[model samples]
Target: MLLALYAALGVVALPRLLSQVAWFERAPRLAIAMWQAACASVVVSALLAALAVAVPASVLGHGLADFFEACATLLSHGVPFTSASARIALLLAGVLVVRITYCAACVLLSARRERRRHAEMLAIVGRHDSRLGAMVVDYDECMAYCLPGRHGLPVITTGALRTLTSAQTAAVLAHEHAHLRGRHHLVLAAVRTLVRAFSGAPLFARASSEIARLVELLADDVAARGHPRVHIAAALVGLATGRVPDFALGAGGETALVRVRRLLDPVEPLRQRERLVGILTIGVLLAGPAAVAAMPGVRAFLAHYCESFIF
Candidate 1:
């Protein structure tokens, strides 16, 4: 029940709290990690909560021998739990796990299919440009994006080539390259799965949107490392009117205006102490639930294992 409460708070409270924090823009990578950890922590807590309900605390207190014996007996009997509540709790845990797995699989498979189709289309309409290190489509729309996968590559349109300067074009390509190299699609997929699995949940929905925004920021930051920030900002502004397919990671989209501004006037990265604090926060988010769930076992280890060793 305690673990369940924590999970509930994580789902309902964490997102709202994190959304209000301004540090995310300055430290997007850390922010992404924090969001992922929070989501993982909530799921784990829910699973642990159900397991806690299904297993009697007294069984743990007795010792490992008793714990194994009880589990074996249940397996042999083919009736997992004598108590209705325990059976229900176990079933709930199973449902949560299955739902999340199903959603994740669906999101990945769909993205893969889309990417393959888009790749086929690109092969038909686009030509490789050695100078640009990207496939250039003859389309008049100014755009740049990456098709992410094992064979992922950056893509650009001739319209954009005519519109951007050499430096701006390089910056845009760098941004797309960052997306492919970082496998930012996988991060987006994880959050998308959560949103699919729990559609109306504010945490999952907001995280999906926020993480989507953050990834572009992260890509821009990576691009800036190799190219001038002004070039990145100029590229973003030039590509602002263009759009990419839903499955592709683009350099510019609806968030382009904000991203351009951010690129032009960058904030300082998180300080050492602040970065350390963020890392610690992520650790707590990931470990706190497991620690709570293991309290009974920890107590049992001290009471039973320690006593036997001493004797």
Candidate 2:
């Protein structure tokens, strides 16, 4: 029963452990109540696990129980966030390091180039497609759309103008413009930044991929606003091509196969389930140490484990 409890506790905490890596990815859209319920479940499970561990089974249990109680208390005391040795502090510092590095790299390497590219793209608008546009550059294989200052940034490529029919161009323009108007870049950038922070974790990579898809789906949602499905589908097919260079205007990021179908068929919407999972996961992880402090049986279990090692 105690072993079973410990296992359950570990299972409950799994989502939380991954959430620090997941939430910053493509956060799902789900109900608040469900989110909180899952969080509570994780906490309760972890605490129960600790309780099981702390329960003594035999006559030699007293000293081991004492040791476990002490360890549990220390673990539950909450990490000394101000100290570098503290787990919470270390985690925070690691995230900050990633953020600063990302910011620095953007400022030094990508920002200026982006600015120059935006200006150039804007100037060449007349030579390309003219309506419903934003200059979302495909720099470094990452697709990003930018809204020009104040007025709508009508992004036009000479190729899109020549290759696509007027309606197709309009569809593409609407999609990109939706991205600019909607401030989609903020969400996308935030997810990527998080992905970089948790790069060591496998979940982070998966989150990054999901986030990229969600952003595109979000844009497609916008473009689909009062537009024909065929138009949107054609425009997507038009811009996203394998042969296109990363520096040019393109629309190929994540999950192209799925996205094309969604655009054509028009699903209800992207739900918040992913986001809910993410929040709950983080909650469990943050609560893990706290449970040890609160649960007596878990304290006993750990004490025995420690003493067994000693003996």
Candidate 3:
């Protein structure tokens, strides 16, 4: 029942609710964590629910030991599932497995190809900037972003260097550095993979966009540590029209205007109590599916213990 509710919420409620929440813009890190937790919880709960429905409660209630024995027996004896529910569950699980595997492969191959292409471009046209710890490109478009790899090179355009003030440039560098350090591109890639897998699912589509925005906000926050918020905002404005590479984490994107406004008119960080609540919520989101999945095993263990004591 809990799993059902989770699935429904993931499909129906979460996409709308998360997108409408304005406070998340102010608490980007917490928001990122929550989005990730939500995605993970949905997938895990769906898989667990399928397994729960496929395997008889009677067998599961006897604990992990009994559950495995039953599986072994079925495999050895070539017994077919008797219940219609079990057959449906098995079909759903198989479909999910194939979808997840294909999506993962697509994401990996795409990322690898893009990275190689960008790395080759960098080697050909990029110059080392020892002062800024980045690779300077001679493009006229104002741009600053990071190309993630083993060394994670920061790529800055000549136009950006010419346009931005010294402080603004520093802020942009810090922002890109934050993306590299946090490995935010990987997060975006995962969410994107899910979106690609479930193109029709609003939750995946919304999550992909939200997570992308949140990561930029997070990078902005990190950049704020060393530079004035105004400088970061200015840098964002200057680079707002710049085009980023497909595989790069850029200082500007679709949300550049909103981010500039956020930097200029900053909201107070979440209160400690609020942050604590958010953390607890994330914990519950992750742990709830696991608990539901394990309940039968837990019950079986306790029942066995009681029976042994009586014997």
Instruction: Note the clash tally of each candidate.
Output: 0, 20, 0
Q: So what's the TM-score on candidate 2?
A: 0.49
- Candidates ranked by TM-score, best first? 1, 3, 2
Off by over 4 Å in 2: 1-109, 120-152, 240-254, 269-311
lDDT of 3 by residue, 1-311 (tens): 57867876786677787777667988999999988888888888988888888886667777668889999998899798898888899889889889988998899788978998998989898899999899999998787879997778789999889888888899999999999999998899888888888788778888888899899999999999999999999888777644453556554455877898889998899889888988998998899998998887678778877988999
lDDT of 3 at 139: 90
The TM-score values for the models, in the order shown, are 0.91, 0.49, 0.89
lDDT of 3 at 211: 93
Count clashing pairs, candidate 1: 0
Give the lDDT of residue 17 in candidate 1.
Answer: 88
**Which has the better TM-score: candidate 2, or candidate 3?**
3
lDDT of 2 at 67: 52
As for lDDT, the candidate ahead, 1 or 3, is 1
The residue-by-residue lDDT of candidate 2 on 125-187, one tens digit each, is 433322343443323331224443344465554555555677876666777777667665554
